[model samples]
Target: MSNLISGRLPAGVRPQSYTLDLFVQLAEKTFSGRLLISLKVEKSLQTITLHALDLIVTETQLCGQEALVSIHPSDETMTLTFPETIPPGEQQLSLAFSGKLNQQMRGLYATEVQGETFAFTQFEATDARRMFPCFDEPAIKARFKVSLNVPTHLTALSNMPIVEEKKVGNLKKVTFDETPLMSTYLLAVAIARLEKREIRVGETAVAVWTLAEQVSLGSFALKVTQAVLPLLNDYFDLPCPTPKLDLVCVPDFAMGAMENWGAIFFRDACLLLDENRSSTATQRRVADVITHEIVHQWFGNLVTMHWWDDLWLNESFATWLACKIVDQWRPEWDFWLSFQEGKAVPLALDALENSRAIQADVKNAAEIEEMFDALTYEKGGACLRMIENFLGESVFREGIRRYIKQFQYQNASADDLWTTLERSSAQPLKKIAKDWFTRPGFPLIKIKTSGDTLKTLHLSQQRFTGKKTGTDLNPWIIPMTLKYEDDESIHEQHILMDKQEMDLTLPVQGSLKWIYGNASEAGFYRTAYEGRTAKALSEFAAKALHPIEKIGYLGDLWALSSRGDHPISVFMEALCHFRGDASRVLVSEICSYLEILSRQIVLPADHSRFAAFVDQQLTPLWKKCGWDADKDEDDEKRLVRADLLWALGSIAQDEEILSELPRRQTLYQARPHSIDASLVGTLIRLCALSDGGKRFDQFIEKLERSKTPEQRDHYLLALATFNKPALACKLIDLCLSNKMRAQDI
Candidate 1:
């Protein structure tokens, strides 16, 4: 078996830089490449090994001298054994190889868009071996100079700006500028008949590209890119490394976006927005995704992780910073509330017995693929935000500036970041953050009040799990922030809970009513209290708490209720009390949790009764948001309206909604463009719930006539919303036919 633990190349050799010359034949779906990689040899060795897969190594040379080459196809590697032991020094290894472009979306692949095939690459998490022969690990960061030969009709792009392009006999030879020191996974290339819209922000040139017919939809991405780059440059306190940035909307992309140095690649859905058809929510997503990829240009591309094990270091900062930056850009969106909702995901997922730690063990390719999960992205980001809250935003910002400055153009580990923050804040981060990173599960802080005066507070923690898994893991160093009953002081009791139990004696016990931990929903843990305490906090959540805190209270109640640690009545009571006061995000989270409880917890025989309960719980929100038509509504209104309608249609199955389906279907057919963009999906789902075989056929017709990418996505989602078994079966059969696009399917 191969060395799965490290996944490292053999000792005695390391790559410094690579010079690649590639000839891509789009029609034949194949490419031939010549590579000359400079290496820093440390010790004398007979054989040099590097990662390469699915490529025919035609020739090899060591130190410009002939060498015998051997290929290990099963292990995705190659070895060149020279006639004698190579001396330690700088040396060049030359190779010539050819490989077919893969249909699989990994590595150098061919994607057909509108009947025209285009070549693209996705090499993150060890797939770079499928592209060329090299040391493909993240720490082996190297500068790359690439040259591509493509048909004259196509435009070629890479990780760097094009330095030279010329036509020769119906073919174009495109040479890109040498890239900064970056990982092989960040290396990218695309050759297609594309169009771009460009803008200039400061000295940096930004451009967004897409298919020729959809170039107009690229404007929104371009606008956001121009706005966020300068803001990010200012925030990181580091100048943009590259003079130009390019974002390409690939017709078929496995991930939302790949931050490939200067040239970022995005799935079309994430980057394109048609003003006529897309909703305010779609625009927000476009901005968020664009800002995310651009921030990666600094965090992930400029200063990368030292190894795949520290991949969370690359994702977490970008994810958190994207929310922060977008919130700053649009304060009205209340993005932090949405951020709180996003943070709740990891808390719930990590509480499970099967969940992984943030820094997951990626011993092999399969494990590496799984690391890009909720824990790494959501939990990691939440941890950073919690640290920010504790250390103060100004101090955290300074730490980030120092981190980028210290590790610019170099790989850094998780400890490097903590060390930098500790330096900035002069706080003991290592002690507080160690368990958070190393431990596999999150903690639940239990609160109980005792003493004759009911003023004594007791707090303890144990690993949280769905089943009774027992307390096997050690306690976490939780950063707890608590607010007492009716105490409006911003500087409440903040403690670093390094032990299993903590007891605090209140100075005055006369009227202390309740205490809540992890206030503002900043920390990545759950909290529960004793009977009287939980009830008091539940009531407090109904009136005095911040919206995020209320959301947190509801979430913890649901978790405790589901585990039977707390009564489900407590959850329902809190939902009823907070319904009118909850924000759009809280409403959305409530609906989401109720949906899960209905599916998993509610008995099959009690499904109807549970649905009625949900209808009653959501009634306040439905009345507040209302079912009405309005123009020029804000994103919050749009989102809230959609969520309420969805809960009403799916859970309640109200007769009014069922009766209106036919009329709504007619309106959708006659003036589909006039339907509220946010409610379109909900309306289609209502139709599906109402015996929608005929409506399904009409949706297919609309899908065929979709003029914008957003319309296509909406139609596809509508088709997928069929709940009826027969309709779902028919939808699957339709997907197998030629009508559906492979990417959409």
Candidate 2:
């Protein structure tokens, strides 16, 4: 048995394909399976070891000959020792195994919806062995043919389209076509009474599946995929490999979505969208989530990663590409800025000190699971953006197309991609990629500009430690860009800062109104200004600048302030300019930052002063949106108003807002449908915060009597807001004790 957990399978034998036939007993919460594995032996071997977990192997055979099976449950493996040596040649191994369908969401698990039981599978980064034993590592890619026997009333789905089905009395046996060569982690299955909404894109058939009652809500997701998949195909210059793509919404999903080769599974919250009742934010999220999973059809599923260490290669590319595609699909959403604010900035902040690199080292199952974090998704995308901006998008896309064509249906490492990109762009991409991907921290660029007559820009780089002192860490190959004040010739200068400090000759004019370092926030590094450049940024931010630039400046300012490089007052002064900023995303971000400072950092004695500051800053927005929803308000206006109300009413503890909640609560309970859907959550929370245990009990009763999912969720959140530990514990027990539905859990 292999000793390394979640590592590569031994090199002597390689699996070519798997044929699995399973009988699923939903009532028993168990499954029995027979698997035939085709293999190619590189050397003569007396024994072969394969991964299997929580399963009882009844018998084993090699090439139709009985073999001795020794099980080592600790290593999740079973070793079969043949009496005679198996020579280097093609061979087949077969096994009959049975395992319980556990409740843990890791492997094949069953959930009860209403009164019926449904089974689903989630096996990423290591849990596939529990489903059906085979070579479970990412490098061992193979074709899969799956057949399942279940009750005749249920429908079964796999990674490929259904090829055949037969019924015997009360059970149906369903078979799926052979899937493309892929890793075991991408294999998925769901057995339920699923209703599907279908669409066609060229030769490909796409469908969105959910419960029968929620089938109508799946239309928005289907529409999104139909509109975006073709654009992605055009962008990649490559077609999806499968003829059918099935998107299923499961009630209990571990993550937002899984990028299975052909069958993608999403949480109900992410996939189901009712256009009439959904907000603008909900629409944007649905688009982003669907686009992200679809792009993975090519980027992640077609061209695979060799190991878990380079998992970022799949996630980061998809993260950036999702926004790139969505921006083209819906320009009014301003997805690029959303990407910067949501992904890039937060990741940069997370990568300050003691943060993992883009390409992390994963040794065990737990480490591999933990690697699917912000560094891999957000920072990884930011670094990719940095590379793309430096290499030019045309060249970047060209290289990507070549890379996909070269490594289709195979596993490749980060270097394989860098080398391919180097071929197209003729840049030192391998060096640039290694410096950022291997390091644990990000660089902070400090630019010092002096002399009005002839300005000289001295730029220095160091690892940002969130402290005042600098660390002796290795420098990065920064693809840093600088934009001067409105001179086309000097508008942009691309520099690769390989050393600690370098001097550049800037063509000075007048007093240098502004200098945009990390221009357009293209680079992943933070920038700090000194001398006249600092003054220029302050003045320009106060008067004229794009909303994105304002976001970038404020983000960098807050990051620097956290590191003691700048004062908190500087951030406050910069934020004052956004008092009248109409961009909903930006306004929400400002409100979030204020709440963070007040809740996480400020002392108890300073609460009154902090509340006053928040009230003053948000008063402009409050005046615009008002306490109640205006007649026929814009979608963005409604979203901004709800967010502001949550911040001001709850976090800021506004007395007038708190005072009005009891009246609103009584009115809402009398006529629940009359209250605005957008502000009802805030009203519930305020009700709990204003009146303690009595309001909480009332909210719980409201939750029990609620008919709709939205109101139930709101009431649950309000019930969770109680400050008393005993009450919080009671709410926790109610959630975990199975009193709520599985979907709610």
Q: Against the true structure, whose TM-score is highest?
A: 1
Provide the clash count, candidate 2. 0
Query: Which residue pairs in candidate 2 collide?
Result: none
TM-score per prediction, in order, is 0.96, 0.95
Assess candidate 1 and give its lDDT: 0.82
Superposed Cα deviation of residue 313, candidate 2 (Å): 1.1
Ten contiguous residues minimizing lDDT sum, candidate 2 = 483-492
The weakest ten consecutive residues by lDDT in model 1 span: 485-494
Q: Show pairs that collide, candidate 1.
A: none
Tens-digit per-residue lDDT, 1-745, candidate 2? 4565544456899899999999889998999999999999999999888888888888787866778887777677777888889889989888899999887777898888787888999998788999887888888899999999989988899999999999967899999999999999999989999988999987789999998988888888888988898998888888878988899998677778998888999887778866665556767887898899998888878988998999988999999999999999888778878887865444554546677777988877778888888888888888899899999999999999999999999999999999999999999999999887887777778888876543578888888767767664577889988876633324667888898888987666555557777777788877889877787778777455566767777888888887677789988888886777767777878887887898888999999898898898887888888867767776667777878887888778888778877788888879865666667777787777667677766676777776434556677778877777778887888888765655565
Candidate 1's C-alpha runs over 4 A off are 1-7, 451-454, 487-491, 506-510
For 1-745, candidate 1 gives per-residue lDDT tens digits of 4442344677678888999999998889999999999999998888887888888888888865777777776667777778888899999899999999997778999988778889999999788888788898888889999999999889899988889998877888999999989999999999998999999988888888888888999888877877788889899998788888999988788888888888889888899988776777788888888898888988888899977778888898888999999988888988888788887778778877877778866766777788898788888888888888889999999999999999999999889989999999999997777777767888888898876665688988888888545465577888778877633333356777878888987664365666778778888888878867766776666676888887788888888887888678878887778766547888898888777877677888998888788787877767766666566567787788888777777777766767777787689778977677777767777776666566788788888888777778877888887666887888889888867766677
